[model samples]
Target chain A: MQILIIAAIICLALSFFADRGKTIAGIKRGGVMLLRILPALLLVVFLVSIFIYLVPEKVITGYLGSNSGAMGIVAAALIGSVSLIPGFVAFPLAGILISKGVSYTVVAVFITSLMMVGTLTLPLEIKYFGRKAAIMRNVLSFFGAIIIGLLMGVFF
Target chain B: MWKILDNFFLLLRETIFFLPLMFLLIGLFDVWVPREKIERHIGYGSGLAGMFWVILLAVAQPGPLYGAFPVAYILYTKGASVRNIFIYLGAFSCMAIPMYAFEIGFLGVKFWFLRLIFSLLVFVSIGFIMERFVGEDFRVREGR
Candidate 1:
């Protein structure tokens, strides 16, 4: 995060040297956008933290680990879509699931949906891309995850 | 309560730290990149090549998924096609290069390779599907 901030500052400084007025204008524009999205950002972080707290990892693994049919894939996809686990944790959990005999399809759907769909981030997404586009993207990605999972089941 | 608050503050701090830099960079993108260039590369007529460009752009970007939203917004204003924007979002969410390296480490090279191929196929189709639903007139709501 510090690296990103430093890099951004350096780029901004370079831009300032190239054209001062445009650089100022860019900063002002960014400031407006930051203020606009602040409420949604705060709300989402709060809600996600609460959700993560309420649902322990064991419960999530229990749900995904137990089921094994078509229902299992759906369950895994749903959990993945809603859960806030980071990639580091999610991939390891997925590895454990595979070792536990979960079908490739279920694990595939779980990881794909976790990465592609963001139920909690919808508020922030809507704030930027509008209600329609944001919702459509998630809906599409959900189905996409399923399709990808099914194909993986066929291949592996 | 304390746990939730602690988690909340941690997530909030992460966002607060990273998002401004995202916005600042996006603002610079909006200012420096000409609309016509964006149009030519990922606009209405950019075709299949546009998808390729967006996937590469998405891979190059390094950040949490939320950071991609504002960049997508700027791309839209600069006249990137709806399909291309959706593709960008899908790729940004799933196909990031750094994330791919981690995925390969945990899931094995075969799993990572197959998932990427499948994800690319599905997301390209999703992008096309969303273009139909979202269409050209979709605009970010003005008043919060």
Candidate 2:
């Protein structure tokens, strides 16, 4: 995140040097863009927060840790799709689950779906990509997560 | 309510920090980068090369999934193919470099490498399938 800030600042400075008017115009466009998306962005944050509260890590670990068949993989994928856990937290939790005898395939589904799919962010995605593109991306990623999980089952 | 507020604030803090800078950079991209250059690299005609270029670009980008949206919109407007945009979003969502190091630490280098390969394959294929549905004419929904 810090790196991103530095990069943006550096680029902003360079762009300013190259063309002050365009740089200012770019910043204004950015502000307008943020305003345009603010409502949907807020809705996403609200939904995600409520979701995190409702589906605690304990509940997720319970479902994903013990069960080890098709049911478990489905559960993992579902939890992953709906929930928004940061990678810093999710990866370590996944490692713990693996240590507790959870299958790599199920963990794979959880991780893949968690990263690739986003239910809470749908409104924002639709705002940008439109309904068809947004919906297709999530749907495709959902299925892709399952397939990748199965492949992990075979290899690991 | 307090728990919700706490969580909301945490999420908001992160969003507030990233969105402005991301949007600014994307806005600058909008002004600076020419349409022909974007089209030459990732437009309908770019094909397999476009997919590879987007994947490389996505990995280098570091931010939350939401950060990718504005850039994707700009790219779409600039004539990047729907397939390349999808690949860019998918790769950005999962293949970020900072996340890569941590994933390897937890899941082992083998798992990291395999997942990376598998994800690229899956997302790229999905991108192809989506482009078939969405087509080159798809326009990103503009401001509400």
Candidate 3:
């Protein structure tokens, strides 16, 4: 809340000096874009809320920790690619998972894929970058997450 | 039912912080930033310096990956290279400065740094692969 306020003030101040017509047009355009993505955004938020109860730490630990191996890495990439948890929650949650015996690689892949690949935002991406480009970006990011996970697994 | 409602409100509270800002900035940049400037810096032929420039901007600029999409669209429409767009998105999603700090605090400096290196390495490599995969098809087929 505080951060957004400060940002709003800064933006208002910047526009005070910048062109008024352009600024108003920009804000209106922003609103249109918001409408476009609102459904997907709402769906993701709804899923996350339900997911909090459905996905327990024990469940995550079971699949992503201990003896879970290469398959764990793959699973982490897949799950994380779809999940859209915020950084504030994801980092701390990931920390706990790692401390509780989830391998660092799994945690890393989960975070990396969660950030890099966005299943929830696919519609918006397709609208902007076209279907082929959007799909390619996500798929490549999926593999990228796995490769990074493997590297982290080997090194750390 | 009440649980779902309560959860929805909580999610709205958080979304309020990010979504508006992301959209406002995207909208502002769309109108305010000139197309020519984007092309000069991050366009198809800008090469090494452009890659470095976008990565630097991506790391320094603070926002979620969603904020990046509109700006990237603007860049693409203005003729920014596919490679540069790939790098920009890669860096935007994976290399947040505050997130890095958080990672270090939670996971230790060595671990954070190692992950950071690997993330950048993979992003660049992916960028190249995407540039090839998307090819002229992206340029010809898509228009904003």
Candidate 4:
């Protein structure tokens, strides 16, 4: 909240130099842009809320253990791809997975996929970058996650 | 009805908080920043310097993936190279600097560094591939 205020104040101040008229116009343009993206952003937020709160944690951790093997990696990749939990939550959750004997490699895949490929944001991504770029990036990152996982297994 | 509204209510606070601020910045940029200025800095001839420049910017920002989309589209319109913009999004989501210290503490130094290195390489490759796949005609004015 403080950060937003600071940014808002700075923008207003800077706009004085940029042009008072243009700044007001900018604020209006910003409002319209906000409205344009609102529906899609809300959809993503809703999906993230459901996936995080509704899905059983045990189901996730259980299938993601080291002994869980290929399926474990796949499960981790799938969950990580969609769940847009913050870094604090995600890293601690990942650490717990490692401690619980989940494969380090699987955890690597999980974190990599979680960060790089936002499956939930596909609508917004497609709306901006178009279908081919959005789909390709996600698809490639999925495989890249698997490769990183395999490498981690070999190295550590 | 209850379930749907329940979910909506749950996320309403955050949506109200962040979206306007994001759009405000975007609006400011839209109004003030010159297209030629952006194009020269991060556009076609900018080369590796542009990728690194954008990565630094992406790392400095602390926002979710959706936030990057609009900023990226703006950059693209203003003449950022296709590949570099994609790399920026990749770095923004994958290896954000705000999250770096936290990541190292939890994931350990070796693990974090390894992921960082590999993710950068993968994203650059992805960017080039995307550049080829989408080609020059993908610009906003051309498409519109």
> Against the true structure, whose DockQ is highest?
1
As for model 2, its CA RMSD to the true structure in angstroms is: 8.7
- Output the better candidate (2/4) by TM-score: 2
The TM-score of the first chain in every model comes to: 0.58, 0.59, 0.62, 0.60
Q: Between 3 and 4, whose DockQ is larger?
A: 3
Model 1, B27-79: lDDT tens digits are: 67667764455444553445777677777777654456777787787777776
Cα lDDT for residue A44, model 2? 66
Give one digit per residue, the lDDT tens place, for model 3 in B1-144: 567667667765745455566567666666765444544554345578878877866765446677788878766776778888888899989886635534654566677788889999999988899888887877522334
For candidate 1, write residues A74-128 as lDDT tens digits. 9888998997765644664566456556677889999999988999988988888
The global C-alpha lDDT for each of the candidates, from Candidate 1 onward, is 0.74, 0.76, 0.74, 0.72
Q: Which 10 consecutive positions of candidate 3 chain B have the poorest summed lDDT?
A: B34-43
Candidate 2 structure quality by residue, lDDT tens digits, B1-144: 689889878767745665676667766766776444544455344577767767766766456687788878777777778788888898988887646534655577778888888998998888889889988557786535
Give the Å error, residue A74, model 3: 2.2
DockQ, candidate 3, comes to 0.35
- Which of 1 and 4 is the better model by DockQ? 1
RMSD (Å) of each candidate, 1 decimal: 9.1, 8.7, 7.6, 8.9
What are the per-model DockQ values? 0.37, 0.37, 0.35, 0.32
Candidate 2 chain A least-lDDT 10 residues: A59-68
